[model samples]
Target chain A: MGLQNAINGIPLEWYLIVAAALFSIGLYGVLARKNAVAMLMGVELMLNSVNLNLLAFWRYLAPESAAGLAFAAFVFVVAAAETAVGLALIIAVYRSLKSVDPETLTQLKL
Target chain B: MTLQQVIFIILAIAVIGSALFVVTTSNLFRGALMLIVAFFGVAGFYVLLDNGLFAVAQVMIYIGAISILIIFSVMLTRGMQAMIPRNAQAGSVAIAAALLFLILLLAFGPFRLVVDLSGVPILSALFRTESARVLGGVPWQFANREVPETYIADFGRALVDLNQFLLPFLLVAFLVDAVLAGAIYIARQRKPAEVIAEREAIAKEEAEELAALQPQPTAPTLPQGAIASTADH
Candidate 1:
């Protein structure tokens, strides 16, 4: 019930393992989903996992320094911007092609 | 196991399971919802890591804004919800992802190389640690300390201080401004006639979907915003 015990009880490796699994799942989503929006969702998952890793490291190894938290914050902003631009591009693509499936939008295929 | 460990396990399971569902589901709408669940789990992790600020940020940013954008895109492209091939190389991709996970586990988990790779100059230089032994072959050699109460305030100062993250902060600010303007431009560039046509087509498609379903007495009403947007034509 001690605060220190609660904070440091969990091993850092657990966070890393969880992040790895999350990243892999996100990879599958990004590579396997044909829908552009679904792919974007996968990317978001990967970014979240990265944030988890950064923050976990910060907590376990370097809580005194603000480097990890600052990096994670930057990641948050980037993820937000990425989603906004990605969805906008998806919408534009759908408007032109009447679909969001990346497979059929092969106009750029050489 | 400690209470924190138990909570960690539960959070991890919830996150990974929902993430799996988000990736594998053919229904985009359902996937988006599950993605939000995964985000909530990650936010819980942030809280467990003793950083409540990020937990709130995770909920606000990921669940609030990003998930809404994803769901909106899902709705905007509705008819292709089901029956589309999820992917042609799904099996191969799954195998590849599993392999990648295994590799990551070996690197980050308990089953790591026994050799003291920290002796290598290159590895030592990368992690910026002196006399630090790599644990499980990962460059993780730092004594844990209790987080100071003023760490959040320190984080804010670090973000603005020129010697630290100010440059990146300003760059990100510029990036966000550009992204917002660009997104609005990209989404709004359609011709008036084209937009009207698409709205009508969506309405017609909804009617068709309803017709295909069992008849109901209640008619679907358009949103007031949709009505106003169309009226701008």
Candidate 2:
């Protein structure tokens, strides 16, 4: 898509749509992937997609609001820590059960 | 095509291909590797969006730390030679395909994408005219009504200062540490009792061998002499 809008020449909607697509694809991955690590990747994808949305809106819609950028940064940090601990738990589970398959991790399954 | 368009195409292709591989690969380790590629693709998208900070963080945190951790966990628990189960729903593949098609048909049917070409020139001008020092420089208080150009820096400062994120930040750190400690504890707890028993057995066998090797009384000469005398008689 060619440039369609300018808030003094910014294309905000395009970024938003792209972010939405990324988020949807991530959702699909999370639903379809069986591996816990892959699921974590999906979660990361979703988070990044959201970050993209936030940054885009910040740049185009609220150029003065540094808050969006700050939130994205915070999101990035949380994502880093989340994956670390999540993968650690996955490793521990694998050690005990010899598989990282989500189906086999039925300890909490009803 | 424009540079942005070309980069977008490449990143899109990378994202889709890697995502497919992540789902389709039978090997979990390979799947994890493909996930790294997908993350890289997303990070590229961040770069295209003019968020260089996010791009670097994506690679360093996701590709560098998380992917390696996943691979290590996979290797430690499952040997490289272990074969993951094949997709058992092979027979339902067609059904799934049909369902996916139906979903796409319904989803894309209603959406008409409107392209606006006028915005590009304005955006290009904004990008070209904006001073790097003002737009990308460190955050500073502005006396003017318009927001300062250092958006990212301002955002960073806000996180630690205005938004009161310090508590959540510390909480997240504590959570991570607790999880790490718990995982280590669990892994240590799962060591097979047989391993300890096997070590003890090996030690016992070594001790017995040492005892048997000790020096014995020298009766060999008497035995030889008795045998010779009996033969002569």
Candidate 3:
């Protein structure tokens, strides 16, 4: 019984904590990384963490409703679109600038 | 701990470690590979959550498509991998991220421990175990019922149902279509001849615009019937 409880009793908080940590790591990646592609990878990590949070809440709080699942599916669509467009933009920028480093693009800087 | 908890812990460690490697690695190609590992870990998480559909979707979309796209982009910009890995503010960003993690932990974790900080009365007072206000601390509504056996089917139906998610579903499909076209448009490599032709076309259009804006002083304006007079001559 104790083992069963331990197995099933993985509280919602654990998932939340993991997702939060992932989000923070992703934020660090986005802010600290100079490579634009690396920054996009960070964005992907953050999105994945958010999806984890959504699915956790869905399973724990409202498994009966399809709302959480729908939201997650939508997030998946948005992430796909984001990845496609982001990578395309990065490739385009690389073609013009001959570099993938974000620091080298200083045209917008005052 | 139970089997599930052990599995969860291992998966969490793998995911977080690979994610860190993805961000911190100097080699962009290695970073892309680590990203695939992290993605697989997240898929394991979905399985642990008892959602096989999402696990499959995660594998198909993230691992198969997105990761491949990232790898292709990394290869397309190959010479950039040798640059310095981090920006100047990396140290400060690390501190900010740690602070953010601490705040997130307090907000989401089961942080109900009463602790005494040594040699810091003010900090101890502030760290007093008050009920964490968000997430795990709140008495949120929980449907304790088992998920329906037809859960996946229900999710599919919900997406296409008129009153539920049909509109958003259609909108997302449209968005994907537009994104696909836009990506192709933006990423396609134009030949030099095509580029020259486009520039020449633009220049011609501008010249026509200028001519229309200011009539030429040396040109004679022909009358309405001047074509008939010229033909007679």
Select the stronger candidate by lDDT from 1 and 2: 1
Docking class of 3: medium
lDDT of 3 by residue, A3-107 (tens): 222215577777878898899899999999989999999999999999999998888778778989999999999999999999999998898778888888887
Candidate 1: give the TM-score of chain A. 0.91
Candidate number of the best lDDT: 1
Candidate 3 residue pairs that clash: none
User: How well does candidate 3 reproduce the true complex, by DockQ?
Assistant: 0.51
Model 3 over residues B3-119: C-alpha lDDT tens digits? 888889999999999999988999999999999999999999888878899999999999999999999999999979789999999999999998988877875667732333533
- Residue B16 in model 1: shift from native, Å? 0.8
Pick out the ten consecutive residues of candidate 2 chain B with the lowest summed lDDT. Answer: B134-143
Clashing residue pairs in all predictions, respectively, total 0, 5, 0
Best by TM-score: 1
Residue range B1-233, candidate 2, lDDT tens digits: 56676677777777767766665566777877888888898788777656677789889887888788777765675643254433345335435544553443333222332233334665445543333222212232222233355756766666566355656656666776876776566555544687677668878988998778754554457878999999999
| Candidate with better DockQ, 2 vs 3 | 3
**Model 2 off-target regions past 4 Å?**
A6-10, A107-110, B79-149, B162-167, B170-233
Clashes of 3: 0
Q: Tens-digit lDDT track for model 2 on A20-109?
A: 556665665566666676667667777877887776666555657766666776677677667767777777676556677777777886
Q: Measured by TM-score, how close is model 2 to the native structure?
A: 0.63
Model 1: residues >4 Å from true position, as ranges? A1-7, B114-139, B193-233
Q: Write the per-residue lDDT of candidate 1 for residues A1-110, one digit (tens) a residue.
A: 12232354877778889999999999999998888999999899999999999998899888899999999999999999999999999998888788888888889889
